[model samples]
Target chain A: MTRIKSDEPTGWFMIFPALAFVGTLILYPAVNSFTLSLHRIYMGLPALGEPFVGIDNYLHLLQDPVARQAFGVTFGFVILSTILEIILGLGIALVIHEHFKGRGWVRAAVLVPWAIPTVVASQMWRFIFNDQYGLANLVLFGDQVSLYVPWLAYPGYAFLAIVFADVWKTASFAGLLILAGLQVIPEDCYDAARIDGANAWQRFWHVTLPLLKPALLTALLFRTIDAFRVFDLVFVMTQGGPGDATQVIQFYGYKTLFTEGQVGYGTSISMAVFATIFILSLFYIRTVGSSLLKRETI
Target chain B: MRYTSKQAWLLGGILLSVMGSLFPFFWFVITSIKSQVRVEAIPPTWFPDWNFSFYQTVFTDHHFLRYIGNSLMVAGSTTVVALILGVPAAYALVRVRMAGKVWILGGLLTVSMFPQIVIVGPVWQMLSTMGGLNTHWGLVLPYVGLTLPLAIWILATFFKELPTELEEAARVDGCTTVQTMLKVMAPLAAPGIFTAAILTFIYAWNEFFLALLLLTDPVKQTLPVGIALFQGEFTMPWGEIAAASVLATLPLVVIVLVFQKGIVSGLSAGAVKS
Candidate 1:
């Protein structure tokens, strides 16, 4: 095979346009956010210029009760949603992997929630959870029941509603990825396992689980990061309401920056989010190693 | 071939899952057509009095059509821009065999994962300073950046699978690198381009946070932000909101149905890999 001569200049030239756009649009804003977090800039009318305040923003975050509550809400949301998505997604993936009539239609149906925008999905759920005219009360209680519980108006129920919505929207995404992984496994392995007198549970534990690790990790990683940074759904559904019951970090940052005009403080929250996501990604990559990036056969 | 208990269980589970996945959308469609009186009625009207008044209100009173135009313009532009920049970069990563390629790919993936909130503050400030706020281009610029990483990843996977002999043949036939890439390689990679375009357009269309922040002017808002902020002065208009939600989601549903195979492969490529 005749090797194309490795031309560094040509490679650099070809890559320049993408690098330039990414650098200006993504990298610069990221660096600017980091810099702004260290300053005291008020976005209020008659804008006060940024002044270097170094770590004060971080300290303020530590003392802010609302911020602390947001962190807790975010943690719970991420953990609960990710776990639920994994279990539900795995079951769906396993079922869809079977040879069934109308399987193609089922797969397409599953992608609908994921296909719809988060805002729309949240609105759909909000209507269902409405206190007065909501389907939840009408159906769960008698049709004539006057007593109603506004699900989104209370803290605990509001939080549960958000979790329920998140899981419903994303579990199919997890299922699709895991289904792709399931498709790649050789049928002969299962045949061989059955020949060796292995039961269904034993085969799944030994063969399926081991081979499915990469896909499982990939699904978990994407879902965790996404759940942590959730904004549009929560924003549209509750606006982190019921006295900051469901405020996640992203929503907190939005309020600080856009609503309160505290640029420095908002950037601090944003920076914290970035750091947390970076650490999580590093953990996944380190544990799963390079195989996460390997191209899987369809 | 008698049906066994296990097969029955599996079939039942599949049926339940399908219903669970699709019921929300069915409800959404039903809500869109309900009358205001019915929408607010207690013992929520299971069977709505067939009414299209909310749809009329959304189209005529709210200027919902303009929001759809804005969304289409932004998402369409973002898809085009991301592809133009991403294709060459993906080609280089695949065929150039550059050093530190793995790190470069990893860095791009990390950028895709950057929480939008982190970037929104700086991006807002930059656009404000440049007098780009409340404009279509302002939103399109950031969306291009956000969608580029995924586009490049998907395109790169496709490019990597292309045989090098095609490139070599084009080169030997007196084609420059640019000519070979544009004339020979791109045509062969059509399916990949289609996949990338669909996904990129969806992301831009569905994005809400930045749209809410930058396009505060009602006329400039996209569908997601527009429908979200459509709360009435005295009361929440569930009927109008539901009608508008259906309209906003219609384009995506159409896309999913028509291009299910491409969308599925594209999603798997971005998530799992090839």
Candidate 2:
């Protein structure tokens, strides 16, 4: 293979447009957000002119009960939704991998949920979970459904409803990634396992599971990070409902920043969320991403 | 031959999963066509009565068409901008021998993963200062930045895979770098371009958080936020909301079904590749 000796200045020039756009739009906001986080800008105050507080915003976040609850809620959400999505996604992937009739249609059907907007999905689910007219209460409770058990209005049920909605919307995404991974596994490996007198379960456990690890890990990393930073689903479904039951960190930060107009405190919350996601991304890249990349090259 | 128990189980599982996946959409469609009285009925109607007034109400009374127009404008402009900026950058990264290219690509990936809430405050402030708030361009500017990383990454992957001999042949034919990229590579990477465009457009269309924060005016709201925030003059209008939701999601659903292969590949490109 011949390596082309490209001019460095030309390369910079080619990349300048994208870099300039991203730098001005993304980098500027990120830097401004960080700077604002260090100040005491209340709602309705211009962020540029806010008084410098020097980490007090971060300290305040630690002491705030709502912020702490949001942390717990966000953690629970990330864990529950990721686990559910992975399990369901794996099952769907495995089933869809089989050479069955109408598999193409099924594959297309699966993408529907993933394709729709999160706000639309959440609203759809909200309608389903409505107390008086929702399908959930009608199907689950039947004739005994006399009293109004507002799903979005209740704390625990509201959280569960959000998780259900998230799992439904995103499991297809996980399935798609895992399905891609499944496609790469050579059929000969499974044939070899079968010739060795291994049962179906044994073949899947030994032959398939190891080969599917990188894909599963990739799917997990994406889903976990996404679930951790979830905003739209929770925002539209219940707006952190009933009394902060479904309030994740993103929703909390949004409320602080937009509704309450506490730009400084809100920016601190945003920073905290970013730091958590950054740490998780680093952890995944170190642990799972390396192996995935190594396997891809091999 | 009669079906085996294992085959039956597999069939059942597949059916169950598909039903689970499509049920919400089915129910949503059902709700859209139900009358207002039936929507709030005690038992909740299982089947629609073929009442199409909600659709009419949503489009006529609610001005949902304007929101759709706004979404198309924003998402379309975002797709165009992301591609124009992203394609060349991706080409440069893939073909050019540059120092710190890896770091640049990694920075793009990291930026892509930023929680939208983190940047909302600053973006809002910036837009407000520039008098861009509540305008289509305000939302489009940020959407372009937000979707560029993914476009660049996907396009870069495609560019890297193209045989270098093609570029060499183009060079031998007296084609400059820009001409070679435009004349030779762009046409060949049409699938990649389609995937990137579809993904970027869907993201911009479906994005709610930024639209909600940036465009507060009812006249300026996009479909997702507009439909979501659609509380009627009095109580919550389930019929109209359902109708609007259907209309809002229909375009994306149709696009996905038509381009399922590209959509799947585009989605799995990042994760499966690296």
TM-score of chain B of each: 0.95, 0.96
Model 1 / residue A100 / CA error / Å: 3.1
Can you list the residue pairs that collide in candidate 1?
none
Over the stretch B1-274, how does candidate 2's per-residue lDDT look in tens digits? 2348669878987887889999888898999998988898877768889999999998889998899999999999999999999998998888888799999999998998888887888888889999999999999999999999989988888887888888888888888778888999999999998899999999999998899989989889999888778787887898998899898888887897789888878887777776
Clashes of each: 0, 1
Best by lDDT: 2
Scored by lDDT, model 1 comes in at 0.87
For residues B1-274, write the lDDT of model 1, one tens digit per residue: 3358769878887887888888876776777788888888777777878899999999898898999999999999999999999998998888775688888888899898888888887788889999989999999999998899999999998887788898898888888777878999999999999999999999999999889998989888999998888878789988888899888888888888887778777788766662
How good is the docking of model 2, by CAPRI class? medium
Off by over 4 Å in 1: A1-6, A45-48, A290-298, B1-3
The best candidate by DockQ is 2
DockQ of each: 0.68, 0.72
lDDT at position A26, candidate 1: 88
Please give me the DockQ of candidate 1 compared with the native complex: 0.68
| Segments in model 2 whose C-alpha atoms lie over 4 Å from true places | A1-5, A45-49, A293-298, B1-6
Q: lDDT (0-100) at residue B261 of candidate 2?
A: 82
